[model samples]
Target: MRVVILFGSEMGTAETVADSVADALSAHDVSVYDMSDFAVDDLDVHDFHVIVCSTYGDGDLPTGAEPFFDELDACAPDLSGLRFAVFGLGDSIYGDTFNRGGEIAAEKLVARGAIQVGEHARHDASTEIRPKEMARDWAATLPVPALTSA
Candidate 1:
């Protein structure tokens, strides 16, 4: 399957995890892109998407993700044929919004008619386990083709 791994990071943990996820899925045709640089207008619904993003100050999306988010919101494309999954990096100590960035991004995608292929994965920065390792494991079990009939 062809997939796109996009990352939005502040301190780089999310970017590192995105790389780990991409590497783990090497069996598939995978392309990596920074959310800030990805051409959302050129996004193809035929490819699966894996979004790895970090929650920045006060549960907001990292700086790198803001432009993509704005472009998506403005364009509001009907992503009914798009397949996606989200992995969020956050510190649980931050309270209820621990992984709010990922949640928000996923919600927006779904709102635009994208088919979420798997459960959203939440990685805790406060944990002893490395985020990259966690992402590796998470990506391994993703039901990537669940929405093939969509």
Candidate 2:
């Protein structure tokens, strides 16, 4: 399947995670994109997507993701058949807003009728865990035939 990995980063961590996810999905036709550069209308229902984003400013979407979500909101595009997965990077020290960026992105996408596949993965900065490793592992679980089968 055609897989697009989109990333939103404030300090490049999410971008790094995106690359990691891409590496794990190397067997497929995968492309990595910066959320700020991708167009909302370009999301095709026939393709699969992975979102890697980092929370910023008290659970707010990162700077790079702001434009994409804004455009997505404005366009209100129909994504009934589109499938996606999310990987969020955040610090647990933030309390209730922990990993909120990915949560918000997922919520918005779902609200627009996009179908989400796989578990919503999160990497907490407060932990000793490596974000890239977690993201790669999470991504590996997503490309299964059962998950992608229409």
- Give the number of the best model, judged by lDDT: 2
* Model 1 C-alpha lDDT per residue in residues 63-90, reported as the tens digit of each score: 9999999999999888888889999999
Q: How accurate is candidate 1 locally (lDDT)?
A: 0.88
Error of 1 at 39 (Å): 1.8
Local distance difference test, each candidate:
0.88, 0.92
What RMSD, rounded to one decimal, does every model reach?
2.7, 2.0
Q: CA lDDT of 38 in candidate 1? A: 89
Best by TM-score: 2
Clashes of each: 0, 0
RMSD of 2: 2.0
Those runs of model 1 whose alpha carbons end farther than 4 Å from true positions after fitting are 146-150
